[model samples]
Target: MNQTQQMNNDAVVEVLNASGASDIVLVCEHASAFIPTALNDLGLSAEARHSHAAWDPGAKAVACEMARQLDAPLVASKVSRLVYDCNRPPDAPSAMPERSEVFDIPGNKKLTRNDRETRVARYYTPFHDRLKQVLSTKPDPVVVTIHSFTPIYQGIQREVEVGILYDQDTRLADAMLEVETGTFVTRRNDPYGPADGVTHTLKEHALPQGRRNVMIEIRNDLIETADAQTSLAIQMSRWVADAVTQSKDISCRV
Candidate 1:
C-alpha cells in the first residue's frame, strides 16, 4: 500500500494552523504509519506495519479536531514511530525499538552507532525543530501532547480511559485532572508515567520554557472512528480550556 516512498524534512513534519490565535500548542508524535522506502517497511509484516508500534491509532484525528476547536497550532510527525518515536530522545532505546510488544522489528535490530545517529538526525530532529519554531511564535504557549494507548498491552488490560501525565512540573496536569470527567474514567499517570519516559516532549519543549504542559493518553478503543475522535476531542477541549483558565487565574490570584 505504497509503504515505500521518499520523505523530506517538510514531508515528515506537519504544522496545522500555524497562525492559530490560541496560546495552546498541540503535538501528536505518532500520527502516521508510513515507513519510508529507504527503511523498507522496517522489515515488518503487513499486520505489524499497521500496529500500535508503528503509530498511535486515531491520535492524529483527535489532535486535529482539538486544534480546530481550540484554534491552536498542531505539529505532527508524518513518519511511523518504528522509524523513530518523536516523543523519545535521541539516546532512548525506544526511539528506535528492536521489538514492540510481540513483534520483532528486523530492520531496527543490530544498529551501529552511526545508524542510530542518522535516524536521530533524519526523523527526530526535524519534528522537534518544527515544534520549536511554532512555539517560538507564541508569547505564552501551553503544550498539550496527544496520544493513544492500547487497552490491552502484552495481554494485560488497562483500566484508565484517559491518562494525564506530568513530570517535575504538574501545573497543567493538576488542573486538567481536577476537571470532572463524565462517563470516561480519568486518572493521573495511569497506564504510563514519568518513569516510562512518556514526558520527554513536555520536559524538553515546555518545562524549560516555563510554559504549562500536559501529556494526554486516551485508550485507543474509545477513539476508533471519526465520530468517536470528534467526540473525544470535544470533551478534551473543554478540559484543556478550563485548565488553562484555572492556571491563569491562579497566577493572577491576589
Candidate 2:
C-alpha cells in the first residue's frame, strides 16, 4: 500500500453480520456509488455518477440478502470504483480507470503518482485491511465475492447471466458451476475471466491462503428490481450453501 497523502478518517468498508459463525465470508467490491465529498463526483457527468461504471447496480442488495440467508459476514467497500477500485491493486490501470465502457472519468484522467497512491491509501488499503480482519476471525473460511456486470458493454451485448470466476484454486468455482443455475446462463468465467483481471479479490484474499474461493457475477439487468434481487439471491443462496456443504463433505471423507 502506497501512502504519499494522509488517509481520510471516513469509513471505507462495511462488515455486516460480523458475529455470524458461518465458515464463509462475503465481499462486495463494487457495492456503492458513493464518491467521497472531496472528489466532486469524480468529475463525472450527472448520468455517469450512478452508472454501471461507478458501481455494480444490484450487487450490494444481493450480497446483503445472501449474507442474511447464509449467516455469513460480508466485507463490502463503501466508495465508488471511480475513486478507487477496491478489487484492483494500485498498479493495475483499472484500479483508477479513466475510461469505463463509454464514460470518461475526468477526475481520474491525468493522475499523478502521488495522487494515485493517495487514493490507494485512502480507499483500497482500508477496504482490504478490514477484509483481512474479517477473514482472520473465521476458523475455516470460504471466500465469496459478489459483483454485477452490464448486459451490454461498449457495443457488444452479453448473453451470460451469471459468471463463476476464479484464479488458480477452483474448488469453489467448480462446485458452484455444478449447481443448478435455473434459468440463468451460468458459465465458468464468461463475460470476464482471470485474464481480464477480474479475480484480483480472489487472488489477493483467498488463493495464497489456500482457501476455497469463488467470484460470482450476476448480470445487472436481471437484478434491476428489488423483487428480482431477492428472488435471485434466494437461488444463489442455495447454490452457495450446497457447494459449501459438498466441499466440506468431500474434505471429511478424504
Candidate 3:
C-alpha cells in the first residue's frame, strides 16, 4: 500500500449509539488523535501538535457524553485536523493548513493538485461522506457540530464563555444565546460563522434544508481537562435539550 493507504488502514472514526430513536445528530469534526506516522509528527513541536490547531483535546469526550444524554448518534472524525479540518470548506485556507503554531507543515506546505486531492480523498471526503450518510438516514434531524476554541488568541483574552454560531438557523442560536444570558455568550457572525473560505459540513448540508442546526464553540480551557469536559458536557446537554424542545414546538406549528 502507498503511504496514504497505509495511514488510512488505521483510521479511527467513532460513532456512538444511544438507546432509542433520536431526533438529533451530533458531530465533532476535529475530534481525533490520528497522526500519520510517516510524516513523523509533521515536524511540529509537542505543544503545537497537541494544541487546538491539530485537534480538539476533549471534544470527543464531551460529544460522546452529550450523545448519551440526548440519545443521539454522533459521527466524529478519526484523522488529525491538521490532515484536513473537516470543519473547513474544501478551499478554505485552513482546510489544509500550512502552518499551525510555530511549526511549518512540511507535508502541507506546498501542494500540487494531486497532493491536495490525496488528502481530501483520504480525510475530508470520508468525514463528510459519513456525515452525509447519517443525515440521509434521518432527514430533518437537528444537526449540531461541536467545537472548542482557545481562551486566548494571539495575546488577547476572549471573554465570551460560549459562542453560538449559525448561518440559516438563527432560531437555535438565538435560543442558546437567550439561555446563556447573565453568562458570556456571543452570537458570532462567523465567530464560528462561515466565511467564503471556511465553512463546515453542517453548512453544506444543514443550511440548505433549513434544518435546525448550530455550531457551538466552547473555550478550550473549559473543556481541556476531564473534570471540565464532564461539567461542560452536562451543562451543554441541558441547554441543547431545551433548544430541541423549543424547535419541536415551532415545527409542530408549521
When 1 and 3 are scored with TM-score, the better candidate is: 1
Off by over 4 Å in 3: 1-12, 18-20, 181-190, 196-198, 249-254
lDDT for model 1, please: 0.90
Q: Write candidate 1's Cα lDDT for 123-146 as tens digits.
A: 899899889989999888899999
Q: Report the C-alpha displacement of residue 137, candidate 2, in angstroms.
A: 0.4
Candidate 1 residue-wise lDDT at 206: 83
Model 3 lDDT per residue over 1-254, tens place:
58875456337455678332686899998898568887677777777777777887788889988988888899898878888888787777688889865567777888788888877787787677767777777746888888877777777787876777776567776677666645455656534465543346657868777678888887777786788888889889889888777766454211
Clashing pairs in 2: none
Q: Residue 74's C-alpha lDDT in candidate 1?
A: 96
Residue 100 alpha-carbon offset, candidate 3, angstroms: 2.6
> Which candidate gets the maximum TM-score versus the true structure?
1
Q: Each candidate's lDDT (Cα)?
A: 0.90, 0.88, 0.75
Cα lDDT tens digits, model 2, 1-254, are 33533234236888899987898999999999998888888788878987999999999999999999999999988899889999888999999999998898999999999999988878898888889989999888899999999998878899899998888887777788777656689889888899999889888888788788889999999999999999999889989999887776443210
The 10-residue segment of model 3 with minimum total lDDT is 245-254
